[model samples]
Target: MSALTDNTYRLLRAQVTGATDRIVKLALFETVSEVCRLSLSIDPPTDPLSDFAGWLDDDQWLKNHTLVIAGTLARLYAMPKRPWSDIDTARVNKEQYDTLLSYARADAAEAPNIDPTARLLGSIRSRLPGAKDSQTRLALFDVLQEACQRGRIWTELVPFRLVPGKQVFSIAQPGARIVMLLNAQHSVLGMQALNYSDEKIAVRTDIATLNPADLLYLTMALAPSLGADMENPATWMPGDIFASKYTLLLHGVLGAMMLQTAKPYSNTALGQYHTQIYSRELNAAPLTDRDGGLPTRQRWRFPRFA
Candidate 1:
C-alpha cells in the first residue's frame, strides 16, 4: 500500500471504536477551524503569513506545519475575491503593484525580444544580479512578498488553534498533517492530498517521535474536543424547516471559518481535491451563491503581468 493508503486505513481503524473516532474527527475539525480563524481573521482585514519570514528561519518555517497551516489560512484570507472567469486574467492589476511592474518593464527595454515581460524581468535582474532570467527574478520577488503577507495573517490565526489544541494534545501542525495522516491511511477513499509540506507536517505531528498508528488514534480521539459545538449526542433533537436551513448555515459558517483558519492547498492540490470532492458530492464543496461566493474568489488567476 502507498504510505497514504496505510494512513487512511489507520484512520478508519481508529474510527471503528465509535466514540474515539468522533472525538478525534471533531477535534481535528476544531483545530483546523481555529487555525483558519487566526490566519484569516475578519477583524482588521489582515493575513499573518507575510510576517513569518521576519520571525522564522526557512528550516524552522518548513518544519512548522501548524504555522504553515496558519500561513495557508492567512493566504486564503488575504486572497481577493474575483469572478472565476477573470481570476487568471487578474494579475496584480498593474495598479496596486505598479511600482514593481514599471521597474520590471524598464529593465527589459534593451533586450533583443524587448518583451514587456522581459523588460520588467531585466529590470529586476539588474537589482538581483544572480537571477538567471526574468522569470526567476519575478517569481522570487512576488513569492517573497506573498509569503510575507501570509505570515502576518497567520500570527493572528495561530493563537486560536494553539490554545484549543493545547487544551487537548498540543496541536502543533495545522490540521493538514492530521488530514495527511487520515488520507494516508485511507488511500482507497479516493482522497487526494491538498497542500502539505514537511515543515507543515512537523508542527502537528513529530513524525520522528510518534508512532503513525498511535498518533492516528490520538488524533481521532482528540477531534471532538476541538469543536466549537461539541456535545454528547443528545437524546432528543428538534426537527423544523428552520433546522434544515440552520444546519446548512451551520456548515457554511463553520466551513468558511475553517477556510479562513485552515491552510489552503496550492492551486494544483486545490484542483485535485475539488475534483475529488466533486466526484463524491458535486454540491458539497461550498460553491453556492448564498455562501457569498467566498470560495470562488479566493485563488489567484494567471496573466499576472501585461
Candidate 2:
C-alpha cells in the first residue's frame, strides 16, 4: 500500500478502536469521509469502513494524496467554532490578545504592508453605524490595543431574547413577539451623557471628537481580545456584578466574528492585524477567574497544516 493509504488506514484504525464511546467513533468516521470527499474530489462510500478499504486498493492514488489529506484535517481542527466552554473561550481569547500586543509593539513603518485598522474594519463594517475615515480607524485600533495591554477591556455584547406575548386578534391568531432585554447594563461604553438643563452643559471626554460611547462601540466592533480585568474592575464600572462575564462574552463574540471573516485554506499571507492574530499560536498565559489568581505562561499548539 502507498504511504497515503497507509496513513489513512492507521488513523482510522486508531480512532475507531481507541474510542470507547460510540458517538466519538461515529463523529470521527464522518469527519474522515468528509475529508476524503474534499481532498480527493470524489464521492465517498456510504460505509466509512468500505471507503478505507477502497483507498488501500490504489497504492498510486494513496501516494499522490497523503499530503492533501493531512493538510485538510489540520485545517478543519484549526477553524474556530463557538467555544465548547468558558475555559476554551478564555484560552482562545488569550491567544488573540497576545497577537494584538505583538502588533502594537511592532513599528508600523517597518511593516509598510500591514494595516491593522483595515482588517478590523473589514470584519466589523456590517456592525458600524456609518463609515469612518482612515485616521479614525487607525486611532481606534491603537486605543483598543492599549486597552488590551492595560487590561481595562470589557468584552461582552449586550444580550437580548425574543418572547411571544398575547396579542389582540381573531381566533387562531399568532402571538405578538416581544424582545426581553437581558444584561442590558453590560455596556462597554459605561454610561450616556445627560443634558439636565439649558443652563448646564455636561461635556464628555471624546476620542477624536466622537462620543465616548460611540468610540467604545467602535472599539468593540473590532472584537478586541482582552476583557474586563477582575483585579481592577473599577475601570469597567465599579460594583458591576457581571463585569467578568461580560468580558468573557465579548472575547467569545470577537472570536466568532473573526471566524466569520476567515477564508479557509487561502494562499495569501495574513498581513492585517485581525487576520494575523489567528495565524499562529502565541505563548501567553490563559486567563483565570478572579479568585484563581494571576495567569501563568504556557505554550499553545495548533495542528501543523493549520
Best by TM-score: 2
Q: For candidate 2, report its TM-score.
A: 0.20
lDDT of 1 by residue, 48-128 (tens): 332223333332222222223322222222335522213322232222223222332343245444433333333434443
What is the C-alpha local distance difference test score of each model?
0.27, 0.31
How close to the true structure is residue 261 of candidate 1, measured as C-alpha lDDT? 25
Q: Which stretches of candidate 1 lie over 4 Å from their true place?
A: 1-22, 42-272, 285-306
Q: lDDT value for candidate 1? A: 0.27
